[model samples]
Target: MAIDITVDHAVATLTDGTQLRTPFWRIDSDRDGHHLAMLAAQHGNEVQGIEVARRFADLCAEQLVAGTVTLVPYANLLAIRHRRHSSDLGPEQPGRESQGFNMQQAWPGDPDGNDIERVVYALDAKVIAHSDRLVDMHCWNHFWAAAVLARSDNGVAVQMAEATDLPFVMWRNSPAPEADIATSSHLMYSRGGVSMAIELSGQYQMREAEVDRGLRAMANVAKVLDMIPGEPEIIDGPMLEPLAGNDVVVEAPCSGIFMQSGLEPGQRVVQGLKLGHIVRDDDLETVVVRSPACGRLWKYGRHDMKCDVRLPDQHPYASEGDMLALIVQACGPERE
Candidate 1:
């Protein structure tokens, strides 16, 4: 269970004989500061965070001077290798159900719980329990980009969000979701530590610029925690004053191919703005999609304009109730 920050990378060898990702950690003798954990790929489809995790691990192994940092680059390997978003959809454990909405929410997991739950338990008890802060990196639902989130203590989340300069940083809520729904970031909050989730790029798509944004955001967190030697980096994107509640989501009204003919990502949107069109693949009947709030597109669903270019292996097809895009809201919850 010892993390040799010096270089041994492999953490666990699975029952099937495949070993888990190799992670490195460093412990500071000062003991006056906080322990930090960075995680990625908790959801198989969110690959952007894994790059952040890898980059930070190397940086900490070389530059970290105080406190501790553990980087888990591949938390859910099965989902990752298969390119799915949740372990529930993995081939090996098709019937396993504790994950709920992916490994992010299954916190303080049961030792006797299902496979992914046990993984969550090990991560929380062994890694997060010892930390004072955490950053769980995630990505967009479709081609749509994403925003950062702070859960647990909204006040502390504000501080964490400011540290990782990204688009708008909003507090999901102060009270943690009931334990059953507590995500990794909130679980850290429940344990009295501060945590933030940095969402960038996408669930199967990314722009180099977006990856850089996430990397810079993590470096900012390190600086904020004093885990690194510099001031936190500034995020130049339009920032929303932190607020509670999830970002406004415009759900798919019908199961059809989406066509983007209206507002695009990074563009200001007005309520009732033409969002797009949903052309049912079966019959070519089209349904118009519209905006529910005033904000910018963190991303325009790939279905909108680039559906033909989307690779099925990389992108999950969205259906009714699925969030096609998120608007970094412009006003009150009621207004949205």
Candidate 2:
């Protein structure tokens, strides 16, 4: 199969009168088929997906038999430059001080809006609008395992999620009431195209294991789409399907240093199992953190609060009400 690859940029002018050029690759085969848009690095810290997109593009250029693939390694250029989750320059709009400019939340953005908005607008028009399917790649903190998020109500989205061959698939409703933001995947799904978001494990730096897993997932997606040859591979482990709202998040009872129980993701536990402990920074008291429900451990971390990068990975500090662990009510697993 002959593949034609073209590299292009989606340009957007920032408020500072600087042009932000986001590079994307369009790889097309001689035979026309479905178009797949794979994007990554919406949050600057999540660099694993960016690597995945690059490797996937290279693989497609060599082996893709049909269809067109749009690969965006860095979807949020400013955020990646800043090395942060958002690119907001201190609330360009009034009365929105708390709402930091997150490109993922600013979908179908305004051409004449703020910096992030303008960038999203350019990308939506230049990339997303023309794709038949979209895979919004993302990364979470090191606490959770890799999972795919898909709209429970959309059959196409669910099928795409299943095709990823990831261990966990979280079923979410479109237009999530809690978030109330337009993500790139949500925008694509709303436009009658199949879309799903894959959350890779770890952030800040890329891991070879995670990158390989991401490549496998993307290859599976391509195979399922008939963009490449062969049937999607079936792994042996039972796949976990968890509903979005049916999980329990255990929070810190008091501010202290969190000492985890060394439990890994996918480990089953009964209700009230000891998950971790908090060593009070003030009084030196130890508070044990226990599971609130009977289920498998989904995610566990010190807290979401911003911390110094120099802090040791183990025994990180936590504040009161900060999430220490997440226990999902694991439904019976099903094989794809």
Best by TM-score: 2
lDDT of 2 by residue, 1-336 (tens): 447678999999887889989999999886788889988998776889988988898888888988899999999888788776676533222112326487877898887888989999989889999898999999876777788888889877766778777767888877754554378876776667888889987777888878887888898899888888988775623456655576888889999888888886656667777888989989999999888776666777764433212234324688789788877765444211
Backbone clashes in model 2, listed as residue pairs:
none
- Assess candidate 1 and give its lDDT: 0.65
TM-score each candidate. Answer: 0.68, 0.77
Candidate models: Cα lDDT each:
0.65, 0.78
Candidate 2: lDDT of 250?
A: 86
Per-residue lDDT, model 2, residue 69, is 95
Give the CA lDDT, 0 to 100, for residue 244 in model 2: 55
Structural RMSD, model 2: 5.1
Query: Best by lDDT, which number?
Result: 2
